[model samples]
Target: MEGVVVRRVIPSDNSCLFNAVGYVMEHNKDKAPELRQVIAAAVASDPTKYNEAFLGKRNEEYCSWIMDPEKWGGAIELSILSEYYGREIAAYDIQTTRCDLYGQEKKYNERVMLIYDGLHYDALAMTPVESAPEEFDQTIFPVDYKRSIGPAEELALNMAKDAHRKRSYTDTSNFTLRCGVCQIGVIGQKEAVEHAQATGHVNFQEYR
Candidate 1:
């Protein structure tokens, strides 16, 4: 696998981070108790402050565990708090350290890497934007139509209208939406809005 650039966890990175945590919990059943404790401690801390610090520092000391398989047992969990569409959202998750354990000739590390990979793939599938369509018409008006608003404002207005439509119609309420490529359930307008905010698509005009 190619090396992944594990960027600093800004507040906007929470959803992905949380998805990573869920991936670990679901797939890494054999993770060490001590390791789990460390992850839990990090999650239990103030997410806003911790995420800010993590992003601000962007240093090895702050992110070494995420890159070192031996230190945090190939996985590290963290939280990101971000504001999207004027709403605060939290995302947390455990990420596998990118290392070639088999190449390193460490049997234990190799096993851990396999387990981590399983979780990572599963979590990726579960991400809210994993299955989102890309070609949906987001423009509410025709190109030739006269408009007084910018693209961002138009998008917000469209989102509000879609929210109202979803809230009013039961059949539409059951529809699923995607953020990027991730599929998300639409329980109602509020949930849809939350999902949009969480996935950094707050001003997206696409109905689904």
Candidate 2:
């Protein structure tokens, strides 16, 4: 059978990263809470490694923040989870059409795939056919599986291009947002973060 890499959409909940990782790792999409706990514990257990300089917040504060179900996970979480799972995670960025491999420096023998479309994350799996059952999915691949990895990267690039053509990604650097609390207009992620820091308004809606 000619296997193909397919992008599996994950729910747009705040924990999409964890859910995507969960789906790719265990074929279960509901492991967000458990994964969040894993990240929190990992952070708490190593303050020197996950310090405020790296976390952008106090280690303890970051741990508590990560454990919140509504909080989103990103690079820091990815690194911690990569160490926890002892496998590399290749996250294909739809905006940049680039693959960032977590745990690559760790020299892991296996890796899983995820697609990041700026605002959300999804899983990538190799299947026998487009309509193959999830149980038949192959999300983990050996690092030395050059043939599989090559095609998987191609598929991810194609998916990224398609998403780009659809303008389906949030341009964090240049998007306009309105704070849901104070209803103030802010431009880009930087401004939004500044507004949030000043007013404690964590809720925002993107606008054209």
The lDDT for every candidate, in the order shown, is 0.30, 0.87
TM-score of 1: 0.20
Cα TM-score per model: 0.20, 0.91
lDDT of 1 by residue, 1-208 (tens): 1111121111222133333333223332233343434553454454655563644433333544343332222223421211111111111121212222121111111011111221121121111132333222121111222322134233333433443444432232344444444654355446766876577554322254
What alpha-carbon RMSD in Å does predicted model 2 have with respect to the real structure? Answer: 1.9
**lDDT accuracy of residue 193 in candidate 2:** 82
- TM-score: model 2 vs. ground truth: 0.91
Q: Per-residue CA lDDT of candidate 2, range 71-106, in tens?
A: 899998898889999999999888888888899888
Candidate 2 contains a number of clashing pairs equal to: 0
Looking at candidate 1, the ten consecutive residues that score lowest on lDDT are: 106-115
Give lDDT for model 1.
0.30
